[model samples]
Target: MTKQDALFQYCLRLGDDALILGHRLAELCSRGPFLEEDLAQTNIALDLTGRAQLYFQYAADLEGRGQTADGLVYRRPERQIYNHLLCEQPNTDFAYVIARQLLFSAFDRFLLEDLCTSKDERLVEIAAKALKETRYHLAHASDWVYRLGLGTGESHRRMQQALNDLWPYTGELFEIDDVGLHLLEAGIAADLHTIRALWTPEIRQMLQKAGFEQPADDYMHTGGLKGIHSEHLGHMLSEMQYLVRAYPEATW
Candidate 1:
């Protein structure tokens, strides 16, 4: 693929990850375990959705397509999406949600930091803006990881299980595809392998402080980057695309 194609595809993946995860987190808006947490989740959800909007805008410009951000987000097929498997996984419980956020935000924080220096001016600007938001997200997730992990016996057990259950999907976050390779070679993207090094240590330290043990790295699940997602994504798409599907040309 050409450099522009590769960069555009990579941006779409970033956008899809933020969009899908934001939708999942939005489901918890008024349903958080506590009032304060409900507000916190909603705030994060807004941030993710806002980030996704920015990504889709850039993706549209890069693709040179007439598609608007809303169209790209709400009208795309499953295979066209490039989110990591971890982001699309089911939000089982509070602890599970926090685990997902902890892992994703930590990875994103480093990714954005590196992207802020990209040779591509637009990407560098987007990354610089996103870096500020991601920093807070990482802090929020880290705080929750500690609170749930070091809380009461039940809370600790649940958080630990959440970590173990979600561990397999974590591998996909660092799985670079063909597009990523092109971007990396062009100096428009960060090396996922290098980011992984930083991500692992930060995650490990957070888990340790939370009184949680790392899960055995037995099998690593992959394929989401290639559009092969878990069953959960279909349901998420159904709900997210409901209005768009129902009224193809309807506008607010």
Candidate 2:
């Protein structure tokens, strides 16, 4: 693929990841386990959705397809979305949701930090702006991971179970593909290998502090990054794309 195509596809994947995860978190809008956490989650949800909008806008520019952000986000089919499986997974419970947030945000923080130093001006700018928001997201998730892990017996148990269940999917976050490889070669993206090294120790420490044991090494489920997703993604896209699909050219 051409450089532009690779870049555009990379942007779309980034945007889709943010959009799907934001929607998942938004599902907990008024259902947070606590009032403070409810507000926190909503704020984070908005931050992510806003970031997705920026990503889609950049994608439109790169693709030069005359497609708006709404077209890309709300109109795309299931297989067209390149989000990781972890983002679209159902938010089973508070612990599970927090585990998802913790894993994604931790990696995102490192990724954006590295991206901010990219040789590509546009990517550097986007990363610089996004890094600030992701830092906050990381803090929020980290705090919850600690609180739940170090809290009461039941909370600790639930948090441990949540981490274990989500562990299998975590590997996909650092799975760099062709687009990523090109970007890395051009100095326009972070090194996933390096990010993984930093992320793993930090996460392990957090789990330990929460009095949680790490799960055993096991094979991880992959493929979402390549447009192959779990069963949950189809249902998510069905709901997310309904308005656009129902009225193709309709706009407010």
Candidate 3:
């Protein structure tokens, strides 16, 4: 693929991660365990959506095919999306939500920091903006991981179980292919290999502080980078796309 195509794909990957996870968190609005948690989640969802717009806008300009960010976000089928599998997974429960956030946010925080130094001016600005939000996301989720992990037996077990189930998907966040290498070579992307060194240790420390043991499962679930995802993404697409599908260009 050409350099432009590769960079566009890279932006889509970043946009998809923010969009999918933002929507996932938005689902907790008014459905959280408490009012404060609900507001917190909703706020973070807004932050993520904003970050997604930046990436999607850049991707559209890079593609230069007259595709707007809205078109890319609302018009694509689930199979065309390149979000990580972890972001597409269902919230399931509160413990599951925090577990997913903790793992992904921890990785995101570090990755964005590395990206802040990227040679690409637009990407560096976006990464710098995103890193600010991701740091808080990591902190909040980590607190809950500790709270639930050290609480009563039932809460502790649930948190541990969520970690075990979600751990498999975490590996996908670090899988760099030729597209990644292309960006890296151009100084438009950070080396995830180096990021992984930091991510792994921080995650280990977080889990230990929460009193949760890391699962021994060697099989790491992947494939979302190639547009292959779990069923949850399809359902999410249906809801997210309904308005766009019904109204081609509705503007209020």
Candidate 1: Cα lDDT at 197: 96
Q: Tell me the lDDT of model 2 at 117.
A: 88
Compared with the true structure, all predictions reach lDDT values of: 0.88, 0.88, 0.91
Among the numbered candidates, top lDDT falls to 3
Once fitted onto the true fold, the runs of candidate 1 whose alpha carbons sit more than 4 angstroms away are: none
Q: Candidate 3's residue-wise lDDT over 1-252, tens digit each?
A: 888888999999999999999999998889999999999999899999999999999999998879899989999888889999999888889999999999999999988998998888989999999999999998899889989988889999998888899999988999999899998998888799998999898889878887989777599988888999988899999999998898887953
lDDT of 1 by residue, 66-108 (tens): 8788888888998888899999888799988988998899999
Give per-candidate clash totals.
0, 0, 0
What TM-score, computed on C-alpha atoms, does each candidate reach? 0.97, 0.97, 0.97
Compared with the true structure, model 2 gives a TM-score of: 0.97
